[model samples]
Target: MILVTGATGNIGRSLVGRLAGAGAEVRALTRSAGRATVPAGVGVVEGDLDDPGSLRPALTGVEAIFLLRTGDTDTSQILKTAAEAGIARVVTVSSLLAQTHPDSSVGRTLLRGEQVVRDSGLEWTILRPWEFFSNLLFWAPAIRSDGVVRAPRPGLPSPAIDPRDIASVAASALLEDGHGGKTYPLTGPATLTPQEKIAAISAALGRPLRFEEDPSLATEDPADDLAAAVSFPGVCAVASPGALSTVEDVTGVPATAFRQWAIEHADSFR
Candidate 1:
């Protein structure tokens, strides 16, 4: 059986379904059983990653796990519990900022997660995905209320990826072999600026939308300026090209283009 933490979350929720669709016995871990609505046949159990002792029941008969950063608490004890519970593998969704902003608090948190999973002696795959296409949903309010999106660095281009693709890769790593000890930096097919993303959403919604450059929207942290997975270093790195990678190389499937993602999730903005 495979255990999925953060089962009610965006990626984890989808991952549970995908794994069940792939015929894996999936056990979803969440703090609230009533809130976790996974595919039929998935075992939804109440558990929190921060509370390592609560995971014993969830880890029973489980061989693999998909861990997510849930709290500010340390995850080493939970990983240790997984190892003791006979887990053989773990696939974690970390961040690209773990490399670009290693000194930052968020970056350190991701690094610690990788370290715990790696030291647990289980076969592990770490997915350090860049900013997700779903992040554009943050503008849904503005798009609905004003038909205008406000963001900082409108000219900045990001090789943002589709979360569905990220979930797919995680599913593959959990069920398949040979992904252990590998870190996949997942990104979209093209480098697009915020303006381009706005334009894609506009096309998907079949309406005109405007992009407003708002420097005040930038975070004071400087590193978290993008307000996504990117960092201050990423602010500069994404400005240039060649950072984009073929998602097929990692997941054996083509990356989802922003336009396609916009089309698929257009209703969210509506």
Candidate 2:
């Protein structure tokens, strides 16, 4: 049996379905499975990462686990519980910032989680992915009301990846072989600026929209949350030489483009 934490989240939601569709015996571990909607023929277990004791029921009979990092997660304890439960493999969804800026606190937290997973004495695969394209959902209200997207960082093009691709790669690592001890950094096919993404949404919606950059809204506070998320300095994997694959090189599937993702999720903006 395979266990998945954060099963109700964006990537976990997709990962659960993908694993079930691939005919794997899957168990989804969520704190509130009463409200979670998982695929058929899959087991739903109520568990919380905050409480390691809650994970025992879900870890039982599970050979592999896919973990999603959360603010309240105790990485070492969680890995220890899984290892003691006889779970042999782990696939952790990490951040690109973990690699780009390993010295930052947020970076250190993520790096420490990766280190714990690697040292757990189990076969492990680390998936470091850039920001998720789904984060653009934050612009849904503005686009729906006035067909406009407001943001800062106009010149910084971010490689926003589809959450489904990350799940797909994770499934590959869990169900297939040779991915142990490997760390794959995933990204979207194209690096797009905020304005370019706005244009793509406009075209996908068959209407006109505009991007409004608000430099005044930009904060230089070192403790700012955005600074921890996407404020990495001197790191541009998209512009770097021989950038890593969109995760397709290893998963044998193409990464979804932002425009295509927009088209599929166009109704959200409406």
Candidate 3:
């Protein structure tokens, strides 16, 4: 049986569907059972990675796991429990910044979790995805109100990837063979600036959208600055282009372009 943590999340939900459709005996761990609506045959269990005892029952008869880096609790004990339960493999959704960045708290947390998983003696595949294309949803409210997209950073280009591609890679690594000990850096085909992303959204929505630059990060508002610090990892001046081949190589499919994702999700902006 395969286990998926954070089952209701963007990537985990899609991955659960994919694995269940492929006829795998899928088990999903969620804190609340009230909101988890998975397939009919898939198992839904209440478990938290922070609390390993809660996961012990769910880990029974499980062979593989999809781990989410919650950053709230240390995962070494949970991973050790999985190893003791005879779980063979683990596929973790980590961040690209986990490797190149040690300053950010999120990056450091993920790096520590990755270390735990690696040293747990389980066959592991780590996915270090760049900023997601779905992050454009942050502009939905502004677009719906005034057809404007605002960002605090200026002149930053990021190769944001679609979540579906990440799910695809996860599914492949989980069910198929020959994916152990690999860290894939997933990104989109094109590196687009914030202005370019706004343009893409404008074209997709059939409207003229204006880009608003907020360089100061709104120092007066602590909430706004904190949100910016967490979400804008790859949108700085010195950010580099992320690797794009890992998606195609692992899933045998191309990563969805930012424009394509924009077109598909354009209705959300309206």
Candidate 4:
């Protein structure tokens, strides 16, 4: 059995669906069993990753595990539990910043998690992805009301990836061989600035939306909680050169482009 944590989340939901469709005997961990939406033939177990004891039921009979970094949890305990459970393969969804900026607290936390996975003596694969294109949701309301997108870091270009792309890479690592001990940096085909994304949304929506760039919304600013989720100076993989190629190498396919993602999610602007 393959166990997935954060199964209700954006990437997790996509991954769980795909893995189930591919005929994998999958189990998912959820904070509330009532909230998980796993497909038929899959098992749903209730557990909080922060509490190692809660994970035992989900870990039972599971051959591999997909872990999300739950900050403040005892990672060493989690690894030990997985190892003891005889779960041989572990795939972790790590941040690009973990490798780009190892000194920051957030980066260090991810690095520490990776170490725990490595020390557990189990086969492991880590995926480090750039900014997510789904972040465009932050502009949904602004666009819906006035056809304007208020984007942060309007000048910084990012090869932001789609969450489904991340899921594809995850499923590849879990169901296939040749990925153990490897760290892949996943990203989209084209690099785009925030304004360019706004234009793409406008084109996709068949509307004349405008880009209202906001400079005060730096990821470092305290009021921007959303940016904080993806922020860490000098740590994100978007600035790295070889990230896009790495995704193709591991997945045996090219990652989706930002424009395709925007087109598929265009209804949000309506």
What are the runs in model 2 whose C-alpha is more than 4 Å off? Answer: 219-243
Kindly list the per-residue Cα lDDT of model 3 for residues 1-270, writing each as its tens digit: 999998998899989999999999999899997889999899899987788878999999999999987857667888888998999999998888776565666567777878888898999999998877877787788889999666666646677888888988999999999999998888887788888888999999998998877766544344443345445433434464554688888888888887888898989999
Scanning candidate 4 in windows of ten residues, the lowest lDDT window is 232-241
Could you tell me the C-alpha RMSD of candidate 2 in Å? 3.0
Per-residue lDDT of 109 in model 4: 78
Prediction 1 global C-alpha lDDT: 0.80
Candidate maximizing TM-score:
2
RMSD of 3: 2.9
Compared with the true structure, what per-residue lDDT tens digits does model 1 show for residues 142-177?
899989876555556778888778888999999998
Worst 10 residues of 1 by lDDT: 231-240
Query: What TM-score, computed on C-alpha atoms, does each candidate reach?
Result: 0.90, 0.92, 0.90, 0.89
The predictions' CA RMSDs to the true structure, in order, are 2.8, 3.0, 2.9, 3.4
Please give the ranking of all candidate structures by TM-score, highest first, separated by commas. 2, 3, 1, 4
Query: Model 3 — which ten-residue stretch has the worst lDDT?
Result: 218-227
Clashing pairs in 2: none
